[model samples]
Target: MTEGPDITFVLGTRPEIIKLAPVIRECEDRSLTRSIIHTGQHYDESLDLVFFDQLALPEPTHHLEVGSSTHGRQTGEMIIRIEEILRRERPDTLLVQGDTNSVLAGAIAASKLDIDLGHVEAGLRSDDRTMPEETNRVLTDHASDYLFAPTEQSRARLRSERIPDERIYVTGNTIVDAVEQNRTLAAQRSAVLAEYDLVPGRYCLLTAHRAETIDDEQRFGDLLTGVGRVASHLEREVVYPIHPRAAKSLEAFDLDVPDGIRIVEPQNYLDFLSLEDAASLVLTDSGGVQEEACILGVPSVTLRESTERPETIDVGANRLVGTDPAAIVEGADEMIDRDGEWTNPFGNGTAATQILDTITGAERREVSPK
Candidate 1:
């Protein structure tokens, strides 16, 4: 408990927060010197506490306050600030999760700084180079010292890319750990279902925040219209916890979010998880929600053209419905009334412990001669 690797976690955005939470808790439980640097990439700074506080995790040791901007500017600013933090903190390893600009910046900074880097949820590929996330994942995988892949499929992808097998550990994803642990916590403390007047299995939950879906006015309108039809067709309400960018897009595009869909402000992680657990269906463009929906035994429709988490679709837990009104409605109709009997392909929920044990038990890597 007194001694282990000193680690720094660099994360930005809600998905990173939710997924990395379990690993962070493990670090605390070990009394390891773990430092967190939150990039403040997509969150409102004031609401940052909602994630950390609700998760019962420590607030970040540092916040870079790099809010939304164009992709290039956002990522550039993050790298600059992240490098400053890593140089000063100089933790033995820097940990990053998933494929956000924050992850890319953190990976680049850590690798260049000569600090060992561990990437959780490594080797996932949507295989669409147009997506910034695809580029982030590929680059970060190459940069990482530890590639914690969630499934054999993911591990195979890394092998195909020639990433060293030794660097890869087929540790199950930490989201399994986070969701399994937090849903119980949500049951005890969260009143979200009651507060929203939602009866479990009678309503749909939606979260749409991706730029490719929402930033395009026509696509955004199509998504809303499709969800509206689903809600009206089934006489069930669709609850949307809108992201700031998507909300602004609605006003800027002068798009009408049709009836049968209730627009709500962004929810803290616990409240959102409670909603996910209770929903009859989930429609989302976010990658993390796709996994959460599968893990919670809720059927889902992914709003994007492709998914890195195809295991959800393969397991019969989800359908990949691109941004078309009819497709969305049809996917909803097919999934909404089904018995959700699909097996979870992610993990059995001990990923955080496995990842920490791997890092702790393995000796620090010596640098190759330049």
Candidate 2:
């Protein structure tokens, strides 16, 4: 057994943790030598620590403690800190998921250190460079030695960018794996529905945390107005588990959340899964929420003009209804009336196994040369 450190998984934010939980479990199940590095991008105990317990994941081996800052400052700080950890640990391969600044920094640091880097959820592009995540996705995909695409469309996007075919593998998304693995647990353990007095398939779930949407005062106000209208029209409360950042922006901008929108604190993975699973419709500016809603067979209304997860839209499970109040209401009505029979295009919950197999196989090929 060639055994120093074989692989290091780097992530930050709740979505990264939730999506990566299954992969970490797979590593544990196989007794693979693996380490986790948490960047601390989301330092809130509710958003960060609660998830580790909810998902039953072990504590991260390295905590960078890189709290929030300007985009450039935060990404720069993470690159410096992660590079130091990579140097000290000298793992054979570094793995990063999604397009957060943490992923960008990990990709950059590993590339500079000449370490083999694997990017999970690679090749997703919204084609809108204005979104910070879009830039991160494109840059990390180019920097990565192994690109684990989540779908055939994502792979096609990479080929169009001329990423070498040998470097790309269409591993189904791990979000499906996470959802499938946790749905039953969520139903058994979560009291969110009862706490909120919500009936299954009767309310709309809302999440709006994207920087572009929340940072603009006009856009934020419009989104609130639109969602409020939808709620009034449907005569059902929109249960919004507000992101900390969005909450801050709301207060900073002096915007009042409209009536008919019930705002609550952020939720742990299992609790949030319960909300997503039970909602008749989901409205959000979050990519992960859009994907989850699709996998759960709930119709979703995306509050953005474009989405990297177009697979959801293609399968008729999601609709893009920007921030306009009228569009939001119309889209919500349309989605709510639609049948929830769209087949999930993500996968059959085996993405983590395939990802681990690919990573270990690549490590073996690398060790054979030495």
Candidate 3:
């Protein structure tokens, strides 16, 4: 069974790699020739290269060193680079994951060049246009040829936007696949628990990198104080993997990180998986972390006012506590003390195979679109 070289996956950040790794393995198993292109969006060695190595994904066929820039500038630069790569690779379909500048850029390049675009983690919407990710998701959705929605809610969102229902497939969620697979491996091999001097359920996992929270000095100060407040109130250690931008913002604002809140550099995907698995509760402004925590059945308090993945809240898997110290303290206290049992509204962890099956079937049908 010889499959054609028909897909090129676009990955830039650690989250994209985590969610896409299973799909890449599935493609390899089915012998569907695939190429991966890395846009150096998050170019740090620890964050980017470590994921490729740890996940055992093939070294990217191409790397477009489009480092950090303004949304318009970064995406615009990626469009040019991706278009160049598309010309050289000439794959039948271009695959992108999540809603990032990279995803938007890849979609725009692929669609304009008449290459079929497959968007994994589609149909997610926070309805907060002020956030760049919302804009990326909307633009990428309309441009994609195949939309792999992670849940029923995402599918409903696509239909409302007039995207053809026929083009959408509820392929569970690829992130859950990553979570399930990695947790198993990490449980067996991770020493992070010992290194951090932690006991299970005794600490909170914290990550906040969103511009909305960090870009505002007052809000950022509240976040630091709020996490400190939670740690102080609960007498729990708060393990934070500080994003580079977030660390700089802290220094810029002259906000002193208090004791008992352990601030370390950003972790690679594996370290994060292990850390999250061991946490009593999770706190973040990340969309992906919200779902990851929910699937792991760890209660999560989102620092944002709203989330694109409303299913988390719907299933009581997560809550939005915003940036207020009092609210964060209260939310953390309640979630930490509660019993952990919430139905994962995301999926049962078989998303990657389903996505590939649907895509392969679609490729066959295109021969006779009737």
* lDDT of every predicted structure (CA atoms): 0.89, 0.90, 0.86
User: How well is each residue in 304-370 modelled by candidate 2, as lDDT tens digits?
Assistant: 9899999999999999989999999999989998787998888888889888777777423332210
Candidate 1 lDDT trough over 10 residues, lowest sum: 361-370
Candidate 3: what lDDT?
Answer: 0.86
TM-score between candidate 3 and the true structure: 0.96
Tens-digit per-residue lDDT, 286-357, candidate 1: 889999999999999999899999899999999999989999999999888767788889999989988898
lDDT of 2 at 61: 96
Candidate 2: worst-modelled 10 consecutive residues by lDDT: 361-370
Score every model by TM-score: 0.96, 0.96, 0.96
TM-score of 1: 0.96
Q: Candidate 2: deviation at residue 78, Å?
A: 0.8
RMSD vs true structure, all candidates: 1.8, 2.3, 2.0
Error of 3 at 234 (Å): 1.1
The clash tally of candidate 3 reads 0
